[model samples]
Every structure is written in structure tokens, then in C-alpha cells.
Target: MSQSEQPWWRGAVLYQIYPRSYLDTNGDGIGDLSGITRKLDYIASLGVDGIWISPFFASPMKDFGYDVSDYCAVDPVFGTLEDFDQLLDRAHGYGLKVIIDQVYAHTSDAHAWFEESRQSRDNPRADWYVWQDPKADGTPPNNWQAVFGGAAWTWDARRQQYFMHNFLPEQPQLNVHNPEVQDALLATARFWLDRGVDGFRLDAINFAMHDRAFRDNPPWDPAGRTITRPFDLQRRVYNQSQPEVPEFLERVRRLTDEYGDRYTVAEVASDDPLPTMRAYTKGDERLTAAYSFDFLYASTLTAGRVRRSQGNWIGPLEEGWPSWEFSNHDAPRCVSRWYDGPDRPRFAKLMNALLLCLRGNPILYQGEELGLTQVDVPFEALQDPEAIANWPRTLGRDGARTPMPWEEAGPNAGFSSGKPWLPVGPDHPGLSVGVQEQDLDSVLNFTRKLLTVRRGSPALKWGELSFLDVPESLLAMTRTCEEESLTCLFNLGAEPVEIPEPVNLGGAVLSQSEGLIDREGRIMPPYAFVILRD
Candidate 1:
């Protein structure tokens, strides 16, 4: 199918499920593929168009499932290959497209390719991974730093040389510069395509290629110079985002094209993402869509910030599509990050409207529909290695990975009768899906209503966006198409903000926690949003 004909990803709502923490079926305390197959109906009930399941491939679990030991096989912890087939069958039966995570940039050191590459310098697979020579002073070949901290190069005594790893030491970077390596990775993707996956969420795609010249990177010295994590210390110029990275992406796009309607969303993270996104998805032959961490790490969600961020990539959006996500497995949950007042419910509803109203594919993280708050996990209860290494300074991601709460009164919130790998928070029971499903004003119900609104309007899905006169804490915009035109307004602050008479609607289409009825035509209630249509 041609780009114009593909509708699977356009305006799609993707619900991300972290398979390890989603549900546990057996007494093993970990979520498996079988557990996910059983929950397909629950996920479908969210009104999302598709699902993006995190890595469940064979791995040693060093960095969870990101370190793939075998790209084609399912881990016993997740289930066998047959169990995955059953999952694809069931997800399709519910009319939900399934997109799985593809970690092609690197593989676990335990992988056969890496093992053979490290065995000797002249081996057939020696060039499979990035091998570097040390400088005369016995330093690393380049100044690149690992994302998990320390130098990016690790010395291997067997080969009498150093190899590069952008993430954990156990996860070695593949030399995507090699045509054979690229072909092998493409083959792995083809294996999954044949197995019936709709598409892929490419993990850390920018890290696939590195600077061939092995040049040192310039140092990054911010004014505050405070180090949140070791990875933030230096500017990652040579370590990733090579000019040749897009060529490989184009090749992957061609491979996906062979399997009609199979889309690819490159997960891009860099010191600068606007130009990188433009370069990666600049033409018709590259990835179908891509996403970056612009809003995921923001300290505030003000209207001005949102406009500026959106404005950065809107120009190059014609080159390819853009995917927007407020929260995911790697970042803190949106509800907890954006909340500051007593009216968290109102805050969640407002934010939900803001997210879905944006002009891109909006990815809703699991448990988000239930208004789940971030869990306060004690140091002893922490399971994330990154958190354990850098305690008290960095807030670990464990708080966001807690098991889903399905019932209000059952043990483990009905996630599992067995002990969960990650402890469920005591406060989660009240926010369980079972309890919220019946409530008319619950977050889940509001999510359904919002999705229904989104589905009913093409302007919210594929219309052109134009920003209006937005005040300090107010956001107003218009989305228009050939058939319909609509205006959206939101007051993001705690105090009510006034606006001029909106474009059309006699009254507000959707209001916030408080109503807006006034003689002056000003909207009432802080953090309230409304849609006006002609």
C-alpha cells in the first residue's frame, strides 16, 4: 500500500502495555503473554485503535527486556512462541491492531552474535558489533558516554580491545554501518511481520548508527551545571544521530512496505530532536512516524510551552508523521507530573482533553484511563537498577511500573492472585478499573466520552491547526477541515481567564469540572477546556 492509502496509523490511539508489570497469570509473580491475551477485552474496552506491547522477546533481563538475546523467540518468562501467536490471534479477534517493540539498535552481550564478535578480532561475526581501538594514551576511542553512566566503551579481555555500548554494558551496540548487519536486523523484523504483528515501535532508533570517524564530542556545560543523571553531563554529538542513520531507516521502511500496512514509529532521543526528526523522516522512503521526549520530561505543561514545542516540528511534519505522548514506560506518569492542587480529578480531565486534542497520533499509557497516580515506592521496595545506583537524587521509574489495579477489593487489586513482582500501592484499590468502570464521572468514563468525541470529529483527527490569541494561562486554537471548523480553549492555571467571544458555537461543547455561563461571555473555572463548533 502507498503512504496515502495507509490508514492504520493515521490518527490512531495506541495503548502501551508494559508486559512485565501488566498482569501475572501463574504464581511466578511476573506478567506473561498468556496474561495479556486474557486481558485483550479490557484493553479493547478503552476505545483505543491499537496496542503497543513492550518487549517480550528472549532476553537475560539485564535492562529488563530491552536487551534482546534472541530477536525471533519469546522468553519463557513471557511465554513460548506459540503463546505469542495466540496473543496476536486474540488481539486481532477484538479488532485491535497489535504493534510490538523492536530493539534493533543493540542486543544483549549473551546474544550469539555478540558472543562470537567478542571471541576474536578475525571471526566471521567480529564486525557485527562496534569495535574500537584505544587512543595512544589508553583512553576510549571516542568521548562518547554511556546512557546508563560511565564511558560508552568496555574493554573485553578476550578480544584484547574495547566495544561500545550506549546503554548497559551487557547491551552491546550493533554496527549498523555494515550492510550485512542491517540486513540481519531487517530479517528479524520480517520474522515478526510474518507472525502477524501490525507494526513496530522501534526502540532508540537514533542510536543505531554512530560517527564513523570516531571523533570526540564537545562538552556540554549548562548554566546550572547540575547533574540529574550521568548521561546528561555531555553533549552526545558523535555517539549517536549520525548522518547515515536515515539510510538504514529508509531500508527498514522498504521492508515494512513489503508487508502492507505495517507501520514503523522510530523512537528518537537526542540532544536536539527537531533536526534529527526532520533528517530521519525527511522523505517518503523513511519511517511512517516518529516521536521524541519534548513534553515527557517537561516540568510544567503551560500553553505557551505547548505551542513552542509543537511549533518546533510542525514545519517538517509534512516530511512524515509525528507521534505525541505525555507519558510512557521510561518516564513519570502524566497525572502525577502535572498535578499540584486538590482538584486532581479536574486536572486529569483537562490534561486528557489537551493530549487527545493535539494534532498527532496520541499514545495513552496503561493505567492512565483510570486516573492512576504515581506510587511512592520506598528505597527498599525499588527494583530499578538505575534507581538503586543513584538513590535520593533521581526519582526511579519503579513508581510508574507498578502492577495494574483491576478490582477495588480483591487481593493485589485483582491483577493476580499470586504475589506481584512489583508491589501494588495501597491507594490503588480505590482507583481500580472495576470500581471506575461503573462510575459515570470516573476517569475511565471520561476517557471513553473524549474518545467518542474524537472519533466523531475528523477535525480533531486530521485537520489543520491554527493558534488564536492565547492569554498567560489560557490556550485557544482552531482546527479546520473542508467539512467542519472548530475552536478549542483551555485555562491551564488555577484562576479563571477571560477570552473574547469564540468563533461559533452558541454554547460550549465540552466543559471542565466547573461550568462556564456568564453575561460577559468569559469562561469560568481554572484548568477548564471547551470545544466550540459551527
Candidate 2:
């Protein structure tokens, strides 16, 4: 493809792989690098443009892989540096781009830089992290709190001061205000780019910079609260989404541009995410795309709700791009979250098809193709620190991060010969790849067909989205490019709906539920969708 022909991310589908739970090669109960290498063919068959691997760098696993010890090397638990090279080579061979996670906001306490900074306040590296003296009463510098639970600031006895840790105490937040620290992080990105990484999945990009004055955040009054997640109680204003974040983002953008076509997608989450996303991707030399938790947290599939969430793209996003995902390692599975009971399989198929037809790049979480639902983790069986800390009220993300189910009858669902870290979902065996591959009507096949349809039709990929004036229960829209026009009608309600006028297109190009044709017009089944050509 010529440079002009390739916009880098047009109509792309990025598959996310949570490294530790994807596959276990040695059966040490944890998934590793080589295990991911072995599954390259399977990923390629899904028609994804790239693979976004979550953090696999050296870490203490305090916040799972989000807490990095080494910015450049792969963790020994994952495999040697050689294994990453092999994985990269294999992924490229399959025509799949590799985007590794870049956790720039914080580092594991075990990191060399953190160790040096903690040794003494006057050390050369002491300013690398955010450190502050204690108040007269020996309390933390501010009312800031950690994202995991309480108090974002942690006191270091040696320095006789408190250091900012937005997450856990072991993961100290970096002082992006320091030019040296910014340069060091840029070097890390350059290292991966030099190693042939196509892009980066920036973890908590907005949190990289914080207000220096340590101001108190306003209180948030949530309609309800999760017992396990205290962070939800307070509105996180001062501690995150700092004003200086986009300034550093422009620098990261400049660094990525050195290697042509290298993309960066920021994982942005805040009460005001649309504004932050707009700021991050506003200019020409900034992030390629930004994703927030708008869709992931929503439990309703209503037309008005979906339209309000997705259709409301603010700022320069219309010129820029967006990355959307229904589920990831952090959130509960979409299928299980929205639809329960026997009809879940059908709903899951419909949801996949619906997502594929949307405007921006789509991301498929591992095992989403197989129609995997969230597994119920018991109190004793849970291994996620976040879940363990906030148990009863919050459904810890670990349930969605279980080992991939490859084979129905094989041991450990053929994920590994060794014991897996987390138990596979109970229905995983029936929903395994082996079983789904044989069943033509399976969710996996439905997803593949939907992707193929979208890939074949340029209208659905790069077209403009305009909402059609339809009933509240029906989501009606049209996607059109210069050459082609397609109309998509979805019945989000449980009861059947009938459109009074004839569809603009000749017939539906794809649908999960049955498409009904009547003298009045196209009769849509309950929760059915149709794609018509005008």
C-alpha cells in the first residue's frame, strides 16, 4: 500500500491480548511469550489489523503488568528478550502489527530509577519521582488518595516525605514535569520502535502529569458505590487528567513520527473523557487515537443510550480517530454484562455485528470471538489484587481475564499443559475454539462473517454516520462514502418492530437475528439488524 493510500488505522480491528492469561506454554499456571507466538495463526484468521499486548515488561505484578520495573526488557516470567523478538517476527509474518503497552505514568518501586530516588532526597535521580515533605502534623502532603483504595500519597521513611502513587504504593507516579524523566520515557518508546513495534497502547496516559500544588479534589456523589472500589466515591479531579498531559503527549507523538506510520492509542478514563480525548488528539502531531470507558461501563443496549455515548464525539475527533472496545482485561465481558440467560449467545452475535459496522477502529478482546462470558470467581479463588481489595461490591476484572479456551475436551482447555493461573469459565469448554470451529452457527463464526462483510464493504468502514429518525427502540443509521451508501437498522428492543417505509437498500447485507420481509416493508425480528444498500 502506498503512503497516501494508508492512513495507518482506517477500518482497522485491533485484537487485545492480556499476556499473563492468554496462554501458558510451560504450564507454570501463567501465560507467557512463546504461548502467544503459538497462537499467531489463530489471531491472523480473525482479520484483525493489529495485536495490542498488555504489559509484559519486568514487573512486581503489584498492579499486574501495569507496574513496570524495566522499561526495555521483557520479564523473565514471560520469557527472554529473544522470545519477544520471535513473537514480533511471527506477528509481522502474519501481516499483524504489534502494539505493546506503554505504562509511562508510574513505575514499580523495584525499578532502578525509583530505588535511586528513594535512597536520598538529594540524589541525582531523586527528582525523577514526585516526592514532597510531610506537613507539620506528619500527615500526607494532601488529601490525595490512591486509585486502588485510600490515600494516593505514600510516605517513604528514608526521605521523611510522601511520594505520589496514584495507583499502589509499589507503583510510584513519575514526575513528568522533569525534562529528564520525559526524555527517558521517550527513549523507551524509541527502543520499541527500533525493535519494529508498530505502535503503543498508552496506559493511563492522562495520569502522566498531575497538578504540582497538591490541591484537594472535590467530592463525587455517585448514585451508588461499589464496596470494593473507594475511588468511585470521590471525584478524581486534582490527582489525574492534569492540564500538562497533552503537552507530553505531543512529545510522544513527535517521537512516534520518527518511525513512519507508528500509531499511539491512549487509554483515557475520566468523568470528562471526551474533553480529555479531544485535547490529546486535537492537533496534527499528537496521538493517533484515544479510547475511554464510555461503552465498557454501560449496561444498557438502548438506542438512545448508544447514540448518546458514541454519536457525541467532541472536538477534533471528527478529523481525528477513535478506538472502541466492548470488553478488555479490565472490564466485565460485554455479553454477560448486557445480556444474561439462554439468549446470551444470540445477543453476543448481534453485538459483535453491531460493533463491526461502527465508524472508528474496533478492538476485539481475547476470547470475545468465542462468545466468552465473565466467569464467576469465588472469594478464595480470586487472584486479582484489585478484586481482592474491593471484593463484594465491585466485580473484579480477574473474572474477564481467565485463560483462553482453545480446546473443549483437552486438559486446561488446551490453554496449557501446566495448571492455569485462573480457572477457565465453566462454559468455556463448550465455547472453546475447537467446538466453535466445528459449529458453523457459533458466535465465533458470526463474528468472522461480520468482519468479512465489513472488510468487503468500504461504505461501512470509512463512511459518515448519520442517525435516522426512527423509533426509540430502533437504532437506525446510514453509513455512506463517496461511492457507496448503506443503511443499518437495529431493533434494540425485545418486541418486534416494523418500519412503515421501504428500506433504502435492496436487502440486508448481514444480520444475527432473522430478517423478515413483508408487504409493508422489512419486518425486523426482536433484536434483529439489517444492512441495506441504497
Q: How close is candidate 1 to the true structure, as a TM-score?
A: 0.96
TM-score (all chains, Cα) for each model: 0.96, 0.96
Q: Give the alpha-carbon lDDT of every model.
A: 0.83, 0.83
Q: What is the lDDT of residue 493 in candidate 1?
A: 89
Q: How close is candidate 2 to the true structure, as a TM-score?
A: 0.96
Displacement of the residue 372 alpha carbon in candidate 1, Å? 1.2
Error of 2 at 325 (Å): 0.8
Cα RMSD of all models vs. native, in order, equals: 2.1, 2.0
Angstrom error of the Cα, residue 394, model 2: value is 1.8
Q: Please count the clashing residue pairs in each candidate, in the order shown.
A: 0, 7
